[model samples]
Target: MHSERASLGLQIAAIGGLLFLHLPILLIFLYAFTVEERTYQFPPPGLTTEWFAVAWNRADIWPPLYLSLKVAAVSTVLALVLGTLVAGAMARSRFFGREQISLLIILPIALPGVITGMSLRSAFAIMEIPFSVWTIILGHATFCIVIVYNNAVARMRRLSGGLMEASADLGANAFQTFRYVLLPNLGSALLAGCMLAFALSFDEVIVTTFTAGQQSTLPIWMLNELVRPRQRPVTNVVAIVVFAVTFVPILLAYYLTRGGSETAGGGK
Candidate 1:
């Protein structure tokens, strides 16, 4: 009876936590349609779609959205390439200080975002690099590389070395061995990593703020809107769009990784 009661209590606590986490998002979507302006009164007077149109028509929002997408795409590609190289070296090759290098790759991500932002800002300034889209990409890439590296490393660890050895023994060059033996195994992981990196780069604000000058991303735009209250409902519209754009890809990436995990485990 005590165990049953404890389990019931734990389940109730979990439900409460979930509701606490998502209730505000639910409220945002609900009151976004509420006809009442400015004040958030329960059971809004009426429902309206005006704010959705208003948010879509805003000229200021789209440019930032486009810029963010471009930065995210470019940065994610760069991170994937760089990260894959690092993951491959760490996972497959015996090198000096391999463990240290692996830790170094992950350190930027484990560090506080503010610290990373500050460090990037200082580096850019020291290098005489002006704040621009490139700067934002560089800043975002620091953390984004960790995502790709992690995914690639996990997949590489699960992969057997015998496959690559067999390919090489069959008279394949390094490039061909990697292409035929490793690349096929890594495809899903790389895809998942790229998607996750893109999502992170898209929504990153702190480092972008430190790196971007007179440039804004979608996340920055959202922050400005929240600070200067306009049609509050319009914020919700932006939120919904941003959430959909970012979360869908992330969810897909997660499920892709989960599939990899299952496949690897099944083979074991």
Candidate 2:
């Protein structure tokens, strides 16, 4: 009886935890369909899909959305290239202060978003760099690179050095070996990292705020809408769109990285 009660209590606690975390997200979805345009009623007065059309028709929404997509695409590409190169160097080479360098590479992500934002803002101000879409991309790439680097380095460490040596013995040139052997091995990890980076960059508000100047990304636009809502349900509809955009990539990344550690260098 005690064991049964304990198990029931544990299950109840787990359910409570999940509800606590996800209940607000559920509310956002529910309110997206609400007919009431300005206020959130306890049980929505009526539900309709009209807000979807409202949000879609809003001229202000598209520009920020387009900017966010562009920034995320550019940032993810930059992160993948730079992070992979840094990961390869760290994984394959031993040099003085390597650990310190690795820590520095990851430091921007470990810092608070506000701190990172402020630092980037300050750097841009000092350099007299005009804030534009490129500024947002640069701010996002700082942390995005860390995500890719972490994923890539973890995969690289799991890779067997022997595979590279074997490719060389088989008369594969450096470029050929990398294209054939390393690329295949690193593909999933790099994809996972890029997906994660893109998702993060898309939803990022803090750093984008500091770097964006007169521009607004989707998240920044959402924040502004929340502050001065013209139609509350329309904001919720946009929130749903943002949630879907970020959630899908995160879900895909999770699947890609699942069992990732069990790879080519399992014995090693």
Candidate that would win on lDDT? 2
In the predicted model 2, the residue pairs found to clash are none
What tens digits encode model 2's per-residue C-alpha lDDT throughout 1-268? 5454557889999999999998889999999888888777879999899989878899999999999999999999999999999999998899999989988887887778899999989999899999888888888998888888878888888999999999999999999999999999999989988888898899999888899999989999999988998899989989989999989987787788787663211110
138: Cα error in model 2, Å: 1.1
lDDT of 1 by residue, 70-176 (tens): 99999999999999998888887787898898779878777778888889889987999888888898888878888888888889999988988898889999999
TM-score of each: 0.91, 0.93
Local error of candidate 1 at residue 192 (angstroms) = 0.4
**Where is the poorest 10-residue window by lDDT in model 2?**
259-268
Candidate 2's C-alpha runs over 4 A off are 1-6, 262-268
Clash count per candidate: 0, 0
